[model samples]
Target: MRIALCALLLTGLLVFPGVLPNSPGHLGSLAETALPWFGLGVPLLLVWAAVRRSVKEVTCVLVPAVAWVALFWPGIVDFGGRDLGRADFRVLTVNVGGDRTAPRDVARRVRATDADVVALEKVPGPAMHAYEKELGGRYPHHAVGDTLGLWSRYPLRGVEKLDLGGAWPHAVRAVARTPVGDTAVYAVRLPSVRVGLGKGFTVQERDASAARLARRVADDGTPRVVLLGDLNGSLRDRGLAPLARELRSAHRQAGEGLGFTWPAAFPLVRLDHVLVRGLDATGSTVLPDLGSDHRPVVTGLRAAR
Candidate 1:
């Protein structure tokens, strides 16, 4: 029984979600999203093996244990602080929760990072004025559309709304003329996903939106590009494969730990991301909560010459 359990856990960790059936609530995608958590089973199985005094079972536990370490140990290690000072610029992205009442506080905490660029999502219509008032002095060049906004210290031009096949504007693109060069910055908020008894993990809509966003990014001719926003899905999930194929995640490149940034109180999973192309990620950090449901993700980047 212990051997069987270990084998199952190993298969789940090693198998790509695409190979598994996605029907009945996107089971494959759901498993992939929480992939790292599967390691918990290792401890539980070990305890069970001890209780049963089964030598074979105890040895079998090593299978999943090795697999988990091989798959996730690198991402969990800290390897970023040293290169942070070399970064050319810093960018921050956060989903300030539509219902947040402290826009000024949010803006203040974000500004404290001194990020060269800031991307905000889910800004309530009424609170827009507060954000502008608080962040305008620091980030003079800014753009706002629908629920998404971008603020930059550098001059911004060619600001446009991207059509992600959504009725309301959920993405905006602009060019920031930085000291390094012109970098296309995209502030995006992908559709949210939910899991219910009836629907296992409803991610179809989010996947479709991701496909559209990927196409838009692919079409852009800009050599340096930075994408910041609440992706609503982790990089491990297959739904984000479209964007994952073309861009590199800043956290995976330079962040320490798993970098979870949601449910500000406990942050179990990372729904926010800073993805870049034609640039190197020097460092990444998840900032403290500033009265928003989601914590902000800041990444230091250096434009590749």
Candidate 2:
């Protein structure tokens, strides 16, 4: 028991680097949601050490306990207190649960945000008409690609489909003629990751797709670019390192809290995101659930000078 606890302590200190041979696999990616909870194991070992009255065991437990605190303390405490200089406009992204989520409910939430642009994924053919009718009045310009769609108050130009190695059109790009300037917006939905005993973690497709998306974003010459939708991988995941290096997450810069936005009932992981390049994020936050499993992510941005 002492040896096992000591090993657990050491693992916590290592922070689960991705290159390790026995690394948690798909489990590692999902494990991030409950990273802080791993610290709870340290207390159990401490108590066991106390009962055994073993000095060595107590000393070992301290290593992991301290390591866990050092790693997660910043994430737990909100450091999101920057005075958003001047927001030009806001964008909201939501996965409207295909045909399951009522169009009226989704439309109500979109109306509530009053965002300049709105991006939705998993939009079904059956519910397309309803959304068009409900959002058409407020947002005059709109485009749909496969199951994804974007609605904008500004004029949409140079609309094009984006193929991120998906069989269907899961991504599209358009130039929004805003009051300040024309901004490139990409609404995308990456392939979902799966976990199974045989495959352990299934994200090779998602990773490949992410790489393609990163390449496209890097190649874009637009002065201002914004990506809105479900990438299925969080900013922290190494698989998303390419995109992470090229784009900046709004939540990291201006969100007021942890900014988690999945399983809206009790968000554990942030699968949805608003990432930008050549623009400054003034404010970012998660909105209340719109009768969908994933909550909406909204961000205010300013064109970078």
Candidate 3:
């Protein structure tokens, strides 16, 4: 029992972040979420062993539990969402649940935030027309790929359709010329989560999209890049490892707590995100709901200038 407890703590330490395979960041992430519980549990185990008068067993459990808490507790702090400076440019990314009824609400709410650029997902078929009518004049530069779209208040270049195959927005790439500078924004929506012994997502589309986005960010030579949308996987999940490597999560820079953004009625985990690399993340945060199951993540950034 003592040896097993030590091994559990050791394994979780080694499996974090870049240490493990890229395909399963979530379960690896579970180490972060579940370890505290283990910390709480190990102490209980120590008491039991102590009651048995096995000081050796109690020592084994107590040491690791105390060490584990001390080592990984910093990760528990909310590193996402920071404060924006005067030079920082801002962007808002949200999944509005494809409901046309909220088009006006979406536009009004987003515009009110005074965000310089906006990237929206789950743009409904019915809402597309209304969205265009409401935002077209205001946001002259934009990119739309079926369900996904990017609307900017600035002049945009290299607008193209992002094909996220199989009814899910696996990927798309665009260049946004913000007042701060030009940034390549890759809007992606990965396969939904399904935990099982079997492989959950085929990952063909997800991987392909990730590869393409990574390639673009790598070769584009821009000092800044933003990948935003309903990635379907948390920043810690292995599914987003490829993407995670190339970009830093916006929320991690400024958000508080888990900042969960899914199942809007009662969000338990953050599924929507905005990741950036080569750009200095000034701040990141979640926006209130406007009829979408996924809450929006807003980020403010500044490039090396």
Judging by TM-score against the true structure, name the best candidate. Answer: 1
lDDT of the candidates, in the order given? 0.87, 0.81, 0.67
Q: Model 3, 1-305: lDDT tens per residue?
A: 75446646554553443364435433554443233334555666667786878767776665666666564454456443347654368888878887633788888888877777787877877777787777887788777777777888877787666553466545567788776677888776666555456553344455555666666566767667888888765665554566778888766665545567877777866778888877766766677666788888777788753
Better of 2 and 3 by TM-score: 2
Tens digits of per-residue lDDT for model 1 on 158-274?
Answer: 999987775787689999997679999999998889999988898987899999999999998988999999989988899999999989998888887888888899998889999
Give the TM-score (vs. native) of candidate 3.
0.77
- Per-model clash counts, in order, read 0, 0, 21
| Candidate order, TM-score descending | 1, 2, 3
- What pairs collide in candidate 2? none
Listed per candidate, the RMSD to the true structure in angstroms reads 1.6, 3.0, 4.3
